[model samples]
Target: MKDVYLFSGFLGSGKTSMLTNVIKQLKERNLKPAVIMNELGKLPFDSQTVEEDIPLKEMLEGCICCSGSEKTEAQIQTLLLNEDFDVLIIETTGAAHPVEALDAVYSPLFADQLNIKGIVTVADSKLWLERESLTPQVRSLFLEQIRHAHLLLANKMDLLSESEQAKVIFEMQGINSHAFILQTTNGQVSYKLLENLQATSRISKDDIHSAKIGKHLHLSSLLIEFNKSYTQQQIEDWIKTLPSTVYRIKGYIPVEGVKNPMLFQYAYGLVQWLPEYIKMPAKVVLIGENVDEVKVIDE
Candidate 1:
């Protein structure tokens, strides 16, 4: 039976980071893995961050839970038919609701082909503490993501004090007593976290919290396509001056004097740039709420 794993979390909650580590561990055990990354933009950055040459499918400009349901089914079919993989990992966008995403996985079409392993949710400690500051719609979506998880991964533990981390775990348990809670730093966790996944059982919408009626989330993306290269100092200066509303900024940027394009990721005021060679065009995707596209372009 092919195992299907779902990684659900909020934006910048470290789901992608955790998935990378998990994929590496799975490979060491001789398991082939395929990935499906859902995004709200035309160009994707998280999928490009994955390591180890696994087959990847991008479901862009929509969440799989709602608008991308058909696309999700079709992609699963294509992967199952065209690829030889032992496990499949679906990383939903931060705004995704686990209830609806699981509904797509439990569809009758994939009942025989795919087995529901577990829904792992990654929560940012700092974000959780400041959730009240977020808009009601986004807050509800974030809560629902955590409420329906089978494994709640409390990521970014290093950023918090021991007592703070403990309190976060306590609060998560209050929200989801059934889910197994684990603390992680930089998305590193033991491979045992994926073990003993309850295969047959499925969670329904009613099983989740009493979320808002409709799946409404105010998310905007500033997609920028560029061909020219820039200096390292220029890029770093721009990142420092990013707007407070910007939730994520990722792109493939060519350096002025470097041979390869640099992969850029900035979120939660933390910045990362790694040099990598990709055949795809250089582009930047900025996701945030009520962000000014013109201002983003200026940066």
Candidate 2:
């Protein structure tokens, strides 16, 4: 059976990063995999970021809603027919509703060719708490994404306080208690996501135990692209102005201070600065949850 993994999460929840890491891990183990990413923005940065070329494709335009599914399935079938790989990963857009995205491929058209290996969801610790801000439609999608997954990666674990992290975990576990839960930073937990099918989901009755997503902050995530150079300290000091409610932040930022774009994280008053960019411009995304903060801060 071909393992088809769907990396589902709200926008900016480390889905693309995790998908890339999973591909790399598969390569190290001598397995070839194909990637299909749905991008909300104009750029195809995620497909380009994979370490070594294997077969990468992108479905860009809109979120993977039912309207877009028919068109996307045509692409997926093309990839499966043209490329021979052990696994296929579909990374959804930040605004995507996971259940709808799943329905797109899980349709009778493609379901026979792809075995549903797992649905791995990467959630930002900071953003997951502000579930209240989402419109009823999007919020329904968010919880449905969690409820349907076989695995849940509670990413950006480093951002939350111990108590806060525990509380979110308790809540998530309440959604799909049967799904295996793993905590990660910057989508680095490839081991937990791939090549491990320990068992099947328990299908507990509580998977749909409704919880109110009230009073949560509405978030607008932005991927800031820099055509000009920026100093490292400039970014450091700028991040200080962001509120503590920031759920998760990641991506490459080229520093005037250094050659590589430093990976930044602003959560729970902890800022993680990565070594340097191995590649292009300082592209970083800021996702503020339940934060009455700025829309997209650009340099």
Candidate 3:
């Protein structure tokens, strides 16, 4: 039976980064793996950043909860019929509800051929504290994602103080009394956590539409392409000028003195960088509401 792993999290929770690492681990074990990335908008940047060789199927313009269900079914059908893979990983958008994605996968047609290995949800420690500031519908959607997970990754733990981490863990346990909560930094998680897992979900398709209660988020993507190398201070200065409205920023940058290209990630006011030796173009994609494209470009 082909194992299916579903990853659900809020925006900028590091789902793509963690999923990429998981795929690498699977490849190391000689396990054929395929990826299905679901994005809320038609223009996607995460798909481009994933591993090049893994078979990837992109489900765009909607989350699997409502509009993407039919497409997801079709995509899964194609993967099962034409692709030779032992495991499949479906990375849902941050706005996605895990229950809906699960219902789409458990369709009658895919019953015998596929097995749900686990439902892993990445929780942003910084964002979790700010959940109360969100609209009622969005806040509820965020909690539902955590409540339904078999494994919850409390990511960005490095930024939290000891007391803050304890409180986040305490609240998470209260919300998801049964889930295995793991703390991680930059989404670096163990591959062994993905093995031999079981999902304890009792959610019905009818309850999954809770995602539609809120208005669709008004979001846009701004792609900035630059071939010139930047100094470390120059990169930091540029990131500091980014507006608060821009929630997510990720891409690669070539540094003047560094041999490897630097990977830049900014989410919820946290800025992180990692040196990547791989060949990649210098560019960044900014996703958020009311993004000032001109100002972002000028910076």
Candidate 4:
């Protein structure tokens, strides 16, 4: 039976980084790996991180747990039929609920061919500490992700002090006593550990069937395309004007003086700018609560 791992995390909690590390480790062990990446935006920005050689399927514009379930099953069936791989890793959209995602994967069409593993959630240590600052709906979603993880990663430990780290661990342990929690930086963890790990418990087929599948959160995404180059400072100024409801902003932006569009990412009020050697679409996807009403490009 093929092994499967589901990656769950909040936006910018470092799921993609962990995925990259896992893929590298899998290759090192001579295990073939395949990925199904789900994104809230129409553009598959995160899928670019997966190497061209790896078999990848992209599910965009919706969460796999709800509206995307049928597509999720179809993608899995396609991969299973056409690809030769030992393990499949599904990276759910940040807004996805753990239970619903598992339910979608438990489809009978391909259930017999797979050995289902547990959810591997990546939690932002700092975000957990400051979760109260988020909206009620978002806070609940974040905690649900942590509460359901079997192999939980308390990521971004470098940003926390000794005392803060202790608190983060204490809180995570309180929420999920069964998970094997790891304190990591840049989502780093040992693949050997993952190979031997199993989910604390499986959500039975009955539970999956009984569970509701619909809009799980108030979060939404708005895609913004840039027709003209803007300075980094201009972009930062616009970000400052955004309300606290805005959680994540990511995509390629055309910098005034740069030869190639730079990758811009904003999460939990922190901004990062990385230079991209190759030119990509000059657009940004904003994900947050009621983000569609947000104004853009005028700043």
* lDDT value, residue 78 of candidate 3: 93
By summed lDDT, which 10 consecutive residues of candidate 3 come out lowest? Answer: 206-215
Per-residue lDDT tens digits for candidate 4, residues 140-242, read: 9998898877689999999999999999999999988878899999999899778765431112221112222222223334445566788999889989988
lDDT of each: 0.72, 0.65, 0.73, 0.80
> Top TM-score: which candidate number?
4
Q: Per-residue lDDT for 4-38 in model 3, tens only? A: 89998988998988987888888889999998999
Error of 4 at 207 (Å): 22
Most lDDT-accurate candidate: 4
- Residue lDDT tens for model 1, 39-86: 888988898877647889998888897557778988998988899999
lDDT of 2 by residue, 1-299 (tens): 56777788877888877776777788888888887788877888777776556777777777765588776788788887898888777888867765456555543334435565556778777877888887888878788777766678888989889998898889999987767788789888755445564211111111212222222223223334454556766666667766664544555665674766666555457677777536644455444433323333334
| Every model: Cα RMSD to truth | 17.4, 19.4, 18.8, 16.8
Instruction: List the lowest-lDDT window of 10 residues for candidate 1.
Output: 208-217
TM-scores for all candidates: the values are: 0.66, 0.61, 0.66, 0.67
Ranked by lDDT from best down, the candidates are 4, 3, 1, 2
State residue 96's C-alpha deviation in candidate 2, in Å. 2.2
lDDT for 187 in candidate 3 is: 80
